[model samples]
Target chain A: MAKGEEAAKQLPKVLVLRPPPMFKMFEKEFSEKFQFLKAWESPIPTDQFLAAEASSIEAMLTSGSRPVTADILCHLPSVRIIVTSSIGVYHIDLQECRRRGIAVAAGGDVVSEDVADTAVALLIDVMRRISASDGYVRGALWPIKGEYPLGSKASNCDILVICCALTDQTHHMINKQVLAALGKEGVILNIARGSIIDEKELVRCLVQGEIAGAGLDVFENEPEVPREFFAMDNVVLSPHRAVSTEESSRAKFELISGNLEAFFSNKPFLSRVNIDE
Target chain B: MAKGEEAAKQLPKVLVLRPPPMFKMFEKEFSEKFQFLKAWESPIPTDQFLAAEASSIEAMLTSGSRPVTADILCHLPSVRIIVTSSIGVYHIDLQECRRRGIAVAAGGDVVSEDVADTAVALLIDVMRRISASDGYVRGALWPIKGEYPLGSKASNCDILVICCALTDQTHHMINKQVLAALGKEGVILNIARGSIIDEKELVRCLVQGEIAGAGLDVFENEPEVPREFFAMDNVVLSPHRAVSTEESSRAKFELISGNLEAFFSNKPFLSRVNIDE
Candidate 1:
């Protein structure tokens, strides 16, 4: 039989909404088990392609920052399950999924430890000026610049460490006054989603010396950080990869594959998320 | 009274062998208790100055990276005490101090926590590609480079963490074979003195991909890093400042002062190092 004919003999079709950039590494492995309907790769528009090709698709895969919105879900009437390679379902229309009775599975507790480790790493890098001094040494400015500026202590103070999800209400929660109260010696560390803090005001605070420094893992427009931050020795920038160690990536792949396999086999989902919220 | 005479009358004479750059921040406070004969500032040669002026100097303050050699110690016949603003005293001639029965006080447990924090920070920075990505972001190459290269996982492995003083025997302990055993994915972190590792071999291993990455706070040479390391993304360089935090510095000031006070007052030193070693 031809390859397409053999592929048609696979299990239930799974629509993949914007697979992660790295998903291609595991694409062949996943495709061997289930036929993937690539909505993003269609020559036609997504909606028309989904309606024409994925109308009978009962399972879908979402990974990275792809938003599985209600409008898109309107086309997937047969989607009984949505398996994501992300721990957070904020990108998915959870309410719509609830109304549609679509079971949701997330990339469970595997990433929390890595996320916590990244948070601490960013914190120390900011407060101890590790990344900045690293820049100085790398830039060959140390012999000329003398001592790189001293950074404030990370502990033994009233500094607050808050890590939470960035919902509508909590968006832009860390505004100017909040940073002001944090004071000149205050350090802000953000490992969560960047929209939680007002990035513009954060830049302003950091530039004006209203706040001391920051260690940022995520930005409002990721991969497009402000140019102002580039020159500042006080800020440390990390690409939005707090939970992206090789170990974590392997764990994520296993969990995602397991979830898809479980869904197809009609077994209990491994890491089902409550879609009711 | 003249400034020198008045200063001499007000405080007990204590020689300072290369005072820390930040010592001036606390120098006035320290000077209230002990008259510091600045060896580095002497017009005559250091040996000549020590023989003519500091022969009667019973206490000496060493900070930063100044070497208190056996030859230098020969000039100080009356030296009974030495106080340093560092936890590591590889720069000081311990055998001579032992033979002379001179009590040496060092920055004690106060720096251990900060040093450990730095070690962890460097490890995570190297393993997570934090510093490299930070540089990429700063250089405005993220948009062009796409995602930064994935880094090796740091934990759940047979990772060895060693922090110790650089002694004659321990110098060059981490040579090519040690690094080779660490393999292509191992990461080496140096927060102690630089000579402990064969830095040339380290550079060669890193360049040849024999070992994965390194995070070096101290180098075989200070303020002068290898030009090759300047271009490498896998390496993170810090200017020998693993124990430098504003909070720790204040604690250090208190400890150094207390040690000096204790030594002068004929009380047991707060952080006296065992010179018998």
Candidate 2:
């Protein structure tokens, strides 16, 4: 009978969990354009409180950290869809969502390019000792060590890249075609899951002085490195952190907000995580 | 006349300190075609020993390490000119050579391209963390932490380069025009030697952060970097060691040998430390 009731009847009621920075834009636009309930707070209270207060909520917006767990899904029985702000759904229980007949969306490709760029940056920094040099400067040890160990020229050296996913995008980023154009003259160092590049392959290359050196951030197991690596003079290494950048974070937020808006409008979400066959 | 004396009168003696792997080719050709003495051993003992034993030595060969120092120059006073197979006279005392009026020759532009290529490689390596990541792989630690810091990209970032010379050769190696073409986004960092960089304009550009970072190998003061430089995060700093590479040792050896050959032939030396004014 009322203008607001008429609008609500035409649009879907939505609830957002841990909204990103750009959520404000989505809130302003969705409030005027569609029926939207943006619960952008954290430490969500008990299920009874949500069920009693948000019985009308039809869609839930979330991200990688605060996944829509089975318990949370049961409480939000009226919710027909879930939208995530990340590519990987490792956090969300897909089977639970399927049982509840809730649609899911995620953001994957939006952040891949930025991740690839950061990977290359990490590789170069490790090889050239940029961060170490920075530490030296901060320590006031200028003119540090033996002239930063001159590496073979990029154009003249070979480059080797070892990774699990050789998809179109990843292929484009590290393919031989791109490498040749970039004037790299080295072999690749891809071990499956970052675990295959054993100490032997690395030691052999370094000791024999075969193919200049390598750049790697992934490994077999994580957080545990061998002592022998620390002793070597010609290798560079870092923890698995190629995809975490400030830009990636911002992009992830934007994707999440966009997906939330589309879901609340009953429109086809742009980043559906699990599509029905 | 004695049987050997008649044959010896037509030949010249050449003393080679340490030649490159290619020296064997020269040995074969010169021995079969011309009369010459080639001493291939490194660390040629004492000056007195060389003078007494190699009195007939018409030419002396040396490299960066086995430089034809003023003392060595005095020993080989009969040697008309000196030759080196590499560039950079830091090891070979140019002042001493000038004081003695000795001519020196070196490999002209042979390794400039190579060195330049390596400089770019070092820049990429430092900026990208290549060595560190590779080191991690070798250490058996996969999935390196902080592998790629977010928002660290090369495009439109500031750069700084510090050097002591802006010779035509170095100018070509790290030319601002070329860098601008690559991505007009950085500054030059030169402080080691006056000859390392063009001083007048670099200061203005550095203050503005026009470039995201720098590649410094030298400084105005022999070892003292400016106090202001200690705070900048985007710049790459070194103690004037852009040219030190594993290949430099062999290149130096070859240059020294070339110098020895030219000194005996009464021809122009290869890597002259001091040219006739």
Per-candidate Cα lDDT values, in order, are: 0.83, 0.53
The residue-by-residue lDDT of candidate 1 on A99-132, one tens digit each, is 9899999888888888888888888888788888
Native-to-model Cα distance after best TM-score fit, residue B45 in candidate 2, in Å: 16
Which tens-of-lDDT digit does each residue in A1-277 have in candidate 2?
9997887767656676666433453465556544555454434565655776567677776655565688777777687777766555655767888877888887667766645654454444434444444444444566444234444434445566564442223433443343334242354444323434444555455555554555455443455655555554444555554554455656666666567667655667777865443
DockQ of each candidate relative to the true complex: 0.69, 0.22
In angstroms and one decimal each, the interface RMSD of every candidate reads: 1.4, 6.3
Instruction: After the best TM-score superposition of candidate 2, give how far the Cα of residue B97 lies from its true spot, in angstroms.
Output: 7.9
lDDT of 2 by residue, B1-277 (tens): 9966666656556566555333454555544433444454424566656676565555554554455666766666666555554454554556666766656676555555544543554465445444434444554545344233332444435554433334445643544454454344554444324344543234434556544455554555535566555555445555444454345534654555555555555556665554543
User: Candidate 1, residues B1-277: lDDT per residue as tens digits?
Assistant: 8887787687878888788756987887877777888888988888888888888888888875788888999999999988889887888888989988988898888888889988999998888878888888888787788777666566653354659877888999999889889988788899888889999999999899888788999888878898888888888899877887777888888988898888878889999888786
- Prediction 2 global C-alpha lDDT: 0.53
Clashes of 1: 0
